[model samples]
Target: MWHTVVGAVGLVMGLLPHVLHHIGLLAGTAFVAGSGGTALFGALGLLASVPMLIRLYRRFGSWVAPAVGLLVFAAMFSLSAFVIGPAISGAEGDVTTPSPAPAVDHTDHPGH
Candidate 1:
């Protein structure tokens, strides 16, 4: 059973590199407005969940699988909200401080 779970994770991991590469390439090349941060974070979160998934599936039959996944995802997102919410507000606070822009030296050109 453990071997089967390990094998499945290995199979998924094998496919991950190709998929990740394509996702990154597509996002970088095509989507200038939206960065791939969400996808990257999601993939990382899913990868982290695999082992927990296997264990949950093993302990509880296929019926419980979906609920376990939902719970895990919920927990992950809750944590993300808790952590990311603060950083965002903190970043905004940082920009609130007035840092004056440096003077430009276009004096050499006789615009005056």
Candidate 2:
């Protein structure tokens, strides 16, 4: 039971950086927005969850537990990227109305 809880916590921690980035929280950070900072943070989350994964593996004596972990990670990633992120960033309402385009000047100016 505790192993399941730990795994869930680890998944959330692991995906936090991505979620923050999606919500525009990491926009101003050069490292997090540009380089591989998000990936680094994600890897760290996975590393932190290593103990939980190990425990699951030992308890189940099979690879199924680890595979389930991977599936959960993927599901959470998708959920944040597609649903939660867009909703939080207001991207979902982007299609509601389009802004009017700026008028262009057709007059031609001659320079000597």
lDDT of 2 by residue, 1-112 (tens): 9878877886887677657666554463545542266466656656775786888899999989988987786677557556786787666643577789998765765562
TM-score of each: 0.38, 0.50
Q: Write the residue-wise lDDT of candidate 1 on 1-50 in tens digits.
A: 97897778767755763455566766643432122544554566576676
Off by over 4 Å in 1: 1-35, 78-83, 86-112
- In candidate 1, which residue pairs clash? none
Which sections of candidate 2 miss by over 4 Å? 1-28, 34-37, 91-100, 103-112
Model 1 compared with the native: what TM-score? Answer: 0.38
Name the lDDT value of residue 64 in candidate 2: 98
